[model samples]
Target: MLNDLGGQGAISRAADFIVIGAGTVGLPISVLLARKTGATVICLETGGLRQEEDTHPLNEVVQQGMFYKGASHGRFRCLGGTSMRWGGALIPFQNSDLCNAHWPISLDELTPFIDDVERLFSLEPGPYSDVSFPFELGGTHVNRLAKWPEFRKRNVAALLDADVAAAANLQVWLNAHVVKIKTQTEGVRLEAVSPNGDRLAISGRKLIVAAGAIETTRLALLIDRQNNGAVSALTSALGHNFTDHISAEVAEIVASETALLNKIVGFRFGAAGSMRNIRFELAPQAEARRHLPPGFCHIGFEVEKPGGFDVLREIFRNVQRRKSPPPRVIFDLIANTPWLARAMWWRLVNKRLLFPAHSRLIVHAVVEQLPSPNNRITLSDTCCDRFGLPLAEINWRLSKEDKENVIETSELFRRTWRTSKFASLGVWKSIEPQQIWANIDNAEGIFHPTGSTRMGACPADGVVDKNLNLFGVANVQLLATSVLPTGGGANPTMMLLLLGMRCVNQHAAGSTPPKA
Candidate 1:
């Protein structure tokens, strides 16, 4: 059951498994271990049960190198973690991504866990790679599809609330911030503090750190320093190879054949209540031939009518947040009555999210960052958070090759559009590569921070091994986007969840928890 750390009295100080950061990765793994293994699992969350504006301060970091906006605005510390603010986009890693020699495990090794991930998310069992473009785009680009869960199911805490409550062996402690980790040869102990200055020490046979990428790396760096590298000699690579997806709006398209364009680029609702959207990317052959990093282009729409359905959405969000709509918001909603009515009819009756009539189409391109050691996260000597812990100092930047990947991918799409039948019916507002690259500052790092504390085959290259166990610490494992060796063009949340499940399952099978 969920309990606030401050209110819980005489709680168990030891458990079979201890998970830090009761967020997207932590919560599911905790429930799985409790239900499947019937072992006592305790989860510690840094934030309260609900999302709040005041919690934003806990996620703030100092920028030392390249400025990353996600360091300040992209993360959440609430119960559901960043999934509380997620858009529900589920994109799996491509086969090529797993077999790229960067990852220690291959596609076949990871395939067995995909169905489990789908089941956890309440999605239909199917292959994400099966969806492709009906027509080829000169064999240079391939099509990938991203599935979305229903709006109500987006927040993982809400999705798993019933299961969490039903799990008798699971205990979730909210407002329990882990400030330090103490490791021993046999196990690990976590020192957590509550908002009211109540301190709790929890010990377990095994500990999993599922904090988000940046925070996870920060904690690892701290542990390494505290232990004087006894934790892992590979701690040298702990903060290296930081990566995130780079995206920007590259062009505009005005299509006369709106139906055809919609069929190709519009959102498709599945019979099982999932929404799917297609993105175009470099094919494996083209990627190898060109020696370019992974990248993709997708279509976005700008509402033609003023305020359109967006105003209505804003009002709904405001109500959900328990805030009163401002006068301008109310006025916009009233002025867009006709558009709202049509949008509502399309949504409720047709089961489709409709773009306003005559919506202007925009082309956006995203590229996977080539992992670079220069982009990293380190501890700040000068700054500390409320808990007196060093704030994370992020040094992130896009290399010239990263910028070129975006330019080339965007240009490929522009060229494909020029040769396609839609070209005859539409006008394409294409931008030069130089112009697109110049404006790239507007879309740096789309909040998918990854590759810090990446996995490797040995301690020489990575902080963690294939099983996500820290190089020298056997009882402590890490399950976060930070452990991902490579960040593909797809979203990393689903992949991280899959890896988390695999880590727990492997740990459960390998040995029993030490006697408590």
Candidate 2:
């Protein structure tokens, strides 16, 4: 049940629970929370139902190479979050990502939630699972990527849009931009503004801020600012330790005969482009490790380049101008041989780009960034909202290990490509080591942007504990990308959805929702 906050006399009502940001992570979270014990869950968003914002600002941000100051990852002011046009590229975190002891819990802990998430999103399953565990144990690798014959098609009705809110104990406030959260003696209070000029002050028995990493940190800082001090405890760490996927694309032609080789290097292979085969693989040595430092769970793959350099450059320039870059990440497989892999460079780049029989299939990689305090999001006094909440000034950054992973992963695939049947396909060469760890200057934060207000078992190192409650705040839980202490180099929406489910069950289980 959702009501337009713009309607008169709507700001005085109260809800048992309040969730800000009704997009990707927040939508499912609201649903799960509401269903648990029939709690009244109220969600506040900045956009309305009549309006759709699937691909807002479809301008020329890529080609123009301009700055996307206020732009975000398909950031919707409307409801339904970015799922409306998310490309829905759902992939689960690798075992390495979900197994890190650095995390307060393990993938096993998130197992039940994963099933709920799959059920909620009505996600068509796919593959991936740890060898140590049985496929029936939890969200297995095979089940995750199980061929979803109807992959992109919707299979459930729970997935709603800006027009229709889900049916249940959940109440959505359309076009209500939540600005601040104040912890009152009785409960949590929220200050949300409507598009037409309405300041709704409502109280909730509990509060969750699943407003994406960037926004999550901003909200926390807003609370600290309103309290008359720097955003502290709950940890000044609220805005520190951020990580995002580091990605880059390179293109070239598949020298002849390579097509046959790719066929031999099958399995784990699929075609996204016409006749253009995309080969994705982990380092032959990329097995799960109990320890490899944090942020080590990452994936890399390449695609063949499709269009003219000028055409692509122009398109990218336009995308940059509009602050919306199309997925420039591409991949190609050629790691089978060492000598052949090195020779790949000579066959291509001789004043001509390399390409496969098909169009430009780019070889792309998703690398993880180690958590560092330097890559932080801080409040900007210069940019304040009408109600005095400080706007988020994200100093986007990355680490060196971030880049090495990409190179290593690519090289690993290169060696496999060389030894594989297609070792002599077209000319393939070494990845020129684009942007490596710490030098992160890719497309801002593409598919995955995580860790602003991370979750951990201990209060000293993180903002929210495993239960996802803010470390020093009482009854305040978070539901944003920041909840992920490390984003395991996979698309985050699926995992975020799973976490929301976990929170719902725990909150309803009489666990006394962790103290602030």
Candidate 3:
């Protein structure tokens, strides 16, 4: 039953298993455990029942080590977790990504869980129809991604309202923040605080910390501090190897060619109430020959607004004329002109009603970042959050090789586009690598954070073992993206869903809660 923790005075506080953060990973794990194993499960969510104005404070953290804007942003502190803002693009990792040497487990082990993830989400079967791109398109492959929130309901809401509704043994505790955890010989004790500053302690026979990348990593560091390095990995590497996809706009195609490219790009209606967006992945052969990491280019339409193109042309001409006018002057001139405003309005109306094509093709590149030990999250010495826990000081770093791979991948795409006769990029200027790299400071990290508590064969290399149990800590498990050893070019959502299923099945096998 989904009840507020404040009102659970009559119910049993102890449970057979405890799962933290009822987001994408936590929700499914709790449901599977309750129904499959018939174990009494308690799910703790620090966020409130729903999104409200005052809940943002709970998510506040101090930004250090490379200064990511998403450190405090792009994360939802509600029951559904970050899925509240998820775009629902579920792209699986390439097979090559699964074969990386760092992975203690192989791709074959994870293949069976694909069907389970699909069925759990109620996704239509055989929705991804393979559309092969032309052979001449050397750098990109034809791939598809289906949209989520099918039938106008969020995935988490649908799962709770349908799949988990009949699970009588599962208890969801909302607005319960776990501030400290103490591991005992038989079980784990968690101390959580409510929104009203009331403290509550809950115990479980087994515990899983699935509170996403940032929070989970923070908790691991806290545990190490509390236990005096007893629970932490030997190199004090609990919060190292932090990574996210580096997204950048590398180039733009001409306005007139947008319609032709749209035939090969963007999303289309699919069978079984699904939507498929064609993606052009860097071919494995191409990646090998060029020594490039996994990267893909997605084409999106950028509508030409009233004051944009004119300002660009004016700025270009100003450079030619040696006239140094501020950009604000040009914007003010366009904003104040009545005729220009009307022209922009007519263009908007025509595009909306007359089926007019887009103005430019915006090419976005999503690149895989190699795991570097220096790029990490550490505990802040001087800062703490509202809960008095040391804030996660993220030291996000991207190697020179990472940036160069993006540049090389973009260059390959430019060369591939030139050979395709279907579209013509007339009167276009090629954007240079340095130009794209110049904006690295402003480029926001993709919200997918991984590798802080990576999985490996032993604790010497990673925080968790192959089964995702933290080494030396027998009953504690991690089921979030933080346990991912590597971040591939594809979105991490679909792969994470599969991993969550694997954890439940393995944990349920002969696993029993501790005696009360």
Candidate 4:
């Protein structure tokens, strides 16, 4: 792949619109903007065109990249962004999640966005089957159970195989790390640097901070700190609220010898065998509910769907940072079980006196956590990246709301599994006396963080308005997954993509370089 500069000019030319990131939201949004108005779109990417095919020592334990058994690297640092690692399965936020009161905007507002993402990605119907998957479980697990060769085709993208940094109208800077975003009342000026001493600055009619959640808010905060006392336009909201989906999976289930369970799961939502198949559900216990009260959040389990990863294995090889050990003993682990697991869930994966199967399944769940001051992102005096930008210091904290979500969701999972009719397949079998589960204390993240530089009623309460334009920063809009006012219970990709497209359409109408 040729490492080409996105635009012809080394530094002289400015663009109508500039988008940062280029992964999830960045990828689709840029495509949309360029397609709609033919704007001089310039996208900046820190990662080079080709991913390092070799593995370093990154682990999944702390949001680092991973290669599942030498497949494509888990996180693509290139043009596709993380979407390259996307499983392509699309699902919307739950109905209960639609009216998130804490959110400045509701799910109804995002409904159109969801539809747009589905259509744009060519999302297959299997993942969104109207009829419940043929399994006894509810409609939630459709992405897991049923699978064959077809499922891999859902949610198509054009990011791969293209000279990621080259485009007809899209000027992409491959190694450009946009470190300083100079916001002026006239327009926004961008300063991007490459490791080899390439420095470029150009103004835009509009700016979309398409960097991922962490990176986007990090830059915004730096802009704030840089102009802290210059009567700058940035409000106190640049990097205030930062939160990600906290998923807790405990290895607890013991299947019966006659369980007849596929090592993982086989899902076929409908005729589109490959389109949708993987599935699972959460059944919380009663005590779990008493511990955490619930109202408007989403809680559930994401069990592994049937089918081994042969098709995507090679795709992930280049981006994976770790070569994960082959998983043994397929057992069932509950999502949102971190608190209970830490308190009473099992973790010492090697104990044998009371162990059951060699293979195990994970129950991944995402519950709601309210935005709090403690969980804010801040700028650091040190820790700069390869670019001259300061690395962000994330002070992630678990609130009472997070704790409540876990407890209530865990209790609900216990109930659904043991009592529901769908639990017939050895799901509720009590283990032997010796093999007791242990409880966990805190739930960690799933990289689905959002709400930092949040959208709010005004500058006093939020960073950007509903349009995602920064409160006081003129001509600069943030487009990554960071603008969500209320964190949705579902994966952030679909909604983020929707918002990005919407913003792009708005910019294209009267697009130019941003006001300084």
Candidate 5:
């Protein structure tokens, strides 16, 4: 049942399991445990049951030591968590993803949870597991467009309108911000501020901090400070090695006929009820030859001038940045043009406006960021949010290896395009040799924050064990992209959900309550 935290003494005095943050990651764990294990689960959400006017303010964070401050805006502070803002894109981790050897747990460990993840997302499995796609590049092709179902309509609808009246063991407390977590010999005690501004303490036998990457790191830092070197494993790794998918539009691919493009990339509807846009990456063997990290590049098929859409995007961005209404000319253009008006309305209803189909391929590259100790999140020295807790300061930095990967990968794509029969030399224009990599201005982080509280077999390498349990804290666990040791080239939604399912299964299999 959902309980409003604004009322006096609304929180339950105790719970068997406490899950902080009722977003995509935390919600599944809470629901599954309550249903499968029949355990009393308490889910504490900093946001409300639905969207609110004040949602943006709750996400206020201090971004320091970074050129880009977009990370805070990437996170949504509502009941659905970031999933509220997610596009519902999902992709499985490729076998080559294991090449980095940064992932403490083998891919096999996560494989068992894939079926559960597919079921939860209403997907058909097996397509992603195919050893190779039908894209014909003579084993030299680096990319293919695969599809996955978008989850906003399917998953969010269930969570928002869920009738949990029959779930006696589950309680979801909304508008309750967990400020501090204290680990004790028996369990964990969470200090929270209710909507009514009252201090409340909630205790649980097992604590799981499923807050997103930034918040997860912040809480770890806070807990580390409280323990005073008792859990030094987290204290050392909690705020270090933060990373995201560094993306850029590096080049374009032109084909004489649309069907000819099929030979280069796979475009088929899978049994999963969604189209797969399997992306391109540096081949594993080629990657080893080039000494490059794993990364994926997405190519958008455009039927119209891509520049026109970009211009409109920049205009809207400027208007939003200025926080002012659009000029009268903007309204006049849309008002006079029926198609423009329809596009604007569609964009309002859906975050993604439907772009007119085109045969021209626009290549956008997203490279895996090499882990850097210096690129991290730390407790801000001066800034604090509305809560007394110190704000999180990000020090995101790119590496020399990252630049080399982009340049080399672009060259590989060009070489493949030149050799391929479908891509006519007349239709395709070669990227200037000097500008092998895309302009730095076009490169942006895909906002897949990961590796801050990474998992590893040893404490020296990471903050959590393969099971996602904190090295120093016995009863506390984590479920977020923050625990990912290596950020792959694909979007992280599916893999993260798989990780959550694994945690839930492990906890349920034990089915033992902490001794009182």
Candidate 6:
């Protein structure tokens, strides 16, 4: 059961395992560990049970190098974490992503866990293979499908099993913000405080820091400082090699045949009620030859003008929010009844969201960033949060090579499309690289922060070893996007969850965790 730390004193102060941050990656692993191994587990969440619109004050940070909207946006501290606000897109990393020396483990080693991760989300169990396209771009590009869960299934917290929640061995505590870690002789002790200023010290035989990327690095830095740099001296690569997926709209397609365009790039409804869409990425051989980082391009349809459908959507939202619809909304809905009826029919019969009668098609592309030591996270000397702990200072920037990769990849995609038989169906308005660079703000990170506390084969290069154990800290492991050495073109959520389950499984089997 979910208990409030501020008001509850019935639960124990310690357990066999203590997981910080009951977010996307933390909640499932905690439940699995408790249910599978029957080990007493406690999960600490900093936020309440519900999602909120405004950013939390503690999430504020100093942006020293680049303007990162994710630093203050899209992050939630609630029980569901950012999964509560995400679009539910799921894609796995390519084999080349792992084989390219970006990760300590290869794709073959991680393949066994993919189906398990998919099952956790109730997705169809199978390998996510490349689908054959109607028109091919020779050996250069491959069409891959990205799956999305139904809207109701997106919040991962709702997917937890009732039996697991009611298990006597598992407890989830909310509003328990951990601020300090004390390394002890046997294990570590965490000192947490509630919003009401109630203090609690929780100790465990093992600890897992599954907070999101930036926050995880910040906490690791805090632990290092509290330990008089003992941790950093061993794991020197703790707060370095930061990376994110940089994306931008590289071109606009004015299609003469909307139906063909839709068939080429529209969202497909699967028999299992999930939505799928095709994205174009370079073939493995082509990527290897180009010597560029991985990236992908997808089609984006924009509603050219607001119609009755949009007004009806607004009215529905207003009603759900318990607010009365405005006079203009009612007037507009009445004015376009015919179009509204057509849209409703299309939605019901086609199982697809209706686009505007005339919509613009955009070619959106996202490129993987080369990890750089300069883009890192550090603690601010002057800035502190409400807990009086130093705030994280994010020093992130796109290098010149990064910008050139975007330009080259975008051009390569355009050239490949031009070679296709269906090229004449659309008029392309391509973007110039010079103009794109001049307006560099057009390109931005997609909120996938990674590589601060990266995994390495040895402690000299990474904070965690192959088993994810902190190098110098016994009985403590770190799990988050921060442990990812590279952010591939695919979303990192599935991979992060897979790693979390792997960690739990290793622990369940009585495998001795690596020591410093």
lDDT of each: 0.78, 0.55, 0.69, 0.52, 0.68, 0.78
Clashes of each: 0, 99, 0, 86, 14, 0
Stretches > 4 Å off in candidate 4: 1-10, 53-76, 125-130, 133-167, 227-234, 250-265, 269-274, 277-358, 399-401, 429-443, 508-516
Q: For model 3, what is the error of residue 92's alpha carbon versus the real structure, in angstroms, after optimal superposition?
A: 1.5
Strongest candidate by TM-score: 1
lDDT of 3 by residue, 1-516 (tens): 776766544333788889988887787788888876778898988887666342377666666556676666767666767665556677677766766435888767877887777776666556443445433454455454544433333447444655556777888778788888887779988887776676667889999888888888888777677756766646445788888888778887664654344444545544344445656676655545345667677766565654444554355434322345575966656664764454346444422111123356677777877888888888888888777888888888777787877777677676666766534633234667677897554666888888898887877788888888877665788777878888876788877777888888886777666335
Alpha-carbon runs more than 4 Å astray in model 1: 7-12, 129-133, 271-273, 287-290, 304-306, 315-337, 344-352, 422-425, 511-516
Question: Where in model 5 is the C-alpha error above 4 Å?
Answer: 9-12, 52-55, 129-135, 142-147, 150-160, 163-165, 233-235, 259-273, 287-290, 301-360, 424-426, 430-438, 512-516
Across residues 357-428, which tens digit of lDDT does each residue of candidate 4 receive? 233543434565666766676655666555555556666666556754654454455555566444554454
lDDT measured at residue 436 in model 4 versus the true structure, 0 to 100 = 19
lDDT winner among the candidates?
1
- Can you tell me which runs of candidate 2 are displaced by over 4 Å? 50-73, 129-158, 161-168, 228-231, 250-358, 399-401, 421-427, 431-442, 511-516
Runs in model 6 with CA error above 4 Å?
8-12, 161-164, 287-290, 307-354, 511-516
lDDT of 4 at 306: 26
lDDT of 5 by residue, 46-160 (tens): 8776553423665666655545444656776666676655555677666667646557777787888878876776666665533553435445455534345433333442543
lDDT of 6 by residue, 1-516 (tens): 778888654244888889988878888888888877778888888888865564887789999777887887857888878777666777788888777755788777666877777777667654464455676677777777777765445666766747446878888888888888977659888888888887778889888998889888898898888877877888768889888888877888888776666656777665555667778887777844358888888878767787775786566544332346788887898888887887667656665545555567888778888899889999999999888899999888998888887777788788888888558678677867677675455555888888999999888779898788887777778999989888886778777877887898888898343333
Candidate 2 lDDT over 140-197, as tens digits, reads 1121231111222221112454223554567888767776677865688777777577
Worst 10 residues of 1 by lDDT: 315-324
lDDT of 4 at 301: 26
Model 4 misses residue 216 by how many Å? Answer: 0.1
What is candidate 1's CA lDDT for residue 45? 91
In model 6, which range of ten residues has the least summed lDDT?
Answer: 315-324
